[model samples]
Target: MKQTRTVRQSIVVSAVLLSVLFFLPLAVIEPFRAELFGRETPVEESEPEVGKLDGEVMLQVLNGDMVEEMNLGTYLMGVVRSEMPASFEEEALKAQAVAARTYTLYKIETGGNHGDTADICTDSTCCQAWISEQSARENWGDQADTYAEKIETAVRDTDGQVILYDGAPILAVFHSSSAGLTRASGQVWLNDLPYLQAVDSPEPEDAIPNYYSRAEFSAEEFKSRVMQAYPEADLTGEISTWIQNPVTDEAGSVETVTIGGITMKGSQVRTILGLRSACFEWETEGNTLIFYVTGYGHGVGLSQYGANEMAKEGADWLEIVTHYYTGVTVGPYTPAALQAP
Candidate 1:
């Protein structure tokens, strides 16, 4: 069979373009102080001094009770080295960095951070989990880790204080996907009718699991999601009832809400979980809820999947981030004030 060579050729060309156009140029930027070869470049003396944490920065850092740092160089390199087009533009990369930074600050200040939140696996019921691609691990792992470390170190040096709710450091997780399918953070005073919004909604297109949109949910898809959830149920009408009302073995209260005039039985007493949103759709295939979920993980903050997609399409980090978070800025922080009080 003749494999289509178009995509292969395009990828090769992109790789060549990146090395030649971007990576090769870094050696010439005097202010950056990066080495062309294996040589070390001293941090520039004229580089802006790290600043003291102010009310805004401290609030931003502590509000969510979490903080993260990414070395701009490493972060930029990851986006620059991808199959992005020459037209991807440096400005877009800068924009993405700003948006991501702004969003991070927003979450920290508003939701009080998410420290000690169980890993997606243990907390499966609370949030979803998706695997990073093997290529991402091999190709981008070290760079991404370095970027994260840079950000962390910067924050620490800046004496940035993280706000803790109930004495917890809060939680900070990174991603390349869309904001969740709900409103898990932030606030608005609308005509004095202030209320927290649901923090859930459609998973951003970019955050689909490893480009897993290759599969669509049909009757067959429904069967697969159901089987994954309930292994032994026969796909029959009797089972449909069970699927409709997934009762746990542990005794719990029962309450009902009418959806489209249909009263559905579920756990009584309403509850609000983090970043309210629903991605998986389970249909009744005889007796199982045939779940057809789109995207993966909590649909909040940066969408790593979307980032990957944009990177593939030659978008820089800035472009990817701005597309998700509506309005924000990417600024620098310093270690002046966050010293131990």
Candidate 2:
């Protein structure tokens, strides 16, 4: 009986010792195992919030003395129709849509220059040119349906796409035509933009409407206009001497003209004389100042005629945009992060 009890006790002690031996190593190795093979902390994933402007935008459109609210896409269609000829290539129209959209977004984010109470104005001189769809259709006449379809397709094709510079929407200014080349932003607006650099636009000069325009003014008329703007001018000189030292850019835009002893920028002269473009050459022929002008706009940024020409050459909308806007990327639109104080 004593032997049996001793054997039983020994068996219980061995079992406990074995159990401890097994569990001791496991306990010691568990902590080191985590270090040897990194245990990643479980990260809880939250759902991504939807982006702003979810394919819809609000626009404050100017209608005479009243401001009207319109859908962004609808507004863009009207802008495209009014801004570019409906007869332009589809790719050109698409390019215009993206440009207009980018411009609109930029204006919205940066607080448009029009007014604090209004998002944008219909006045082409103040903001972008906008026209009603009914007016655009009237302009199209027999081709209204076809042209409207094309414009709608272009706008739909490039939906939600914008030209981005450093991840922000570009100003995306466009003009009717260029003087064989696009103007740098600095040359026109005095604000240098990387994407608005001078680029060779292979648009056929003949293809552009009113590519070469001559605006002739009598010497008296020229002097009268100049004097009206710059009242303090010494016009006591030869007619040839009245206009002196005309500085021109590589694109042939007049940078400055010494008129009535006042050095005025080409833009100033263009505005003063109601000229189509700043790219002009003037010479005194008898009592008349014959001004030979080329192109038909401020000559900065994209050229609508040039874009159409590119489209004719098999370049897509993206290619056309990148070509006009140097070093720019066409991508999905994203609202810029607000800068902290």
TM per candidate: 0.34, 0.80
Enumerate residue pairs that collide in model 2.
none
Taking the tens digit of each residue's C-alpha lDDT, what string does model 1 give over 1-23? 13668878889999999888976
Measured on C-alpha atoms, candidate 2 has an lDDT of 0.83
lDDT of 2 by residue, 1-341 (tens): 99999999999999999999999988987877857678755689532121234235666777567888765676787788889999999999999998998898788778787565677777778778888767887988999889978987887778778899998889899999988888888877768999999888876788788888999988778888988999998787678788889899888899888988899889889999989999999888887889999999988788999999999999999999999999988877745432111
Predicted structure with the largest lDDT when compared to the true one: 2
What C-alpha lDDT values do all the predictions have?
Answer: 0.35, 0.83
Off by over 4 Å in 2: 1-55, 334-341
Please give the clash total of every predicted structure, in order. Answer: 60, 0
For every candidate in turn, the CA RMSD to the true structure comes to: 20.5, 19.0
Alpha-carbon runs more than 4 Å astray in model 1: 1-277, 333-336, 339-341
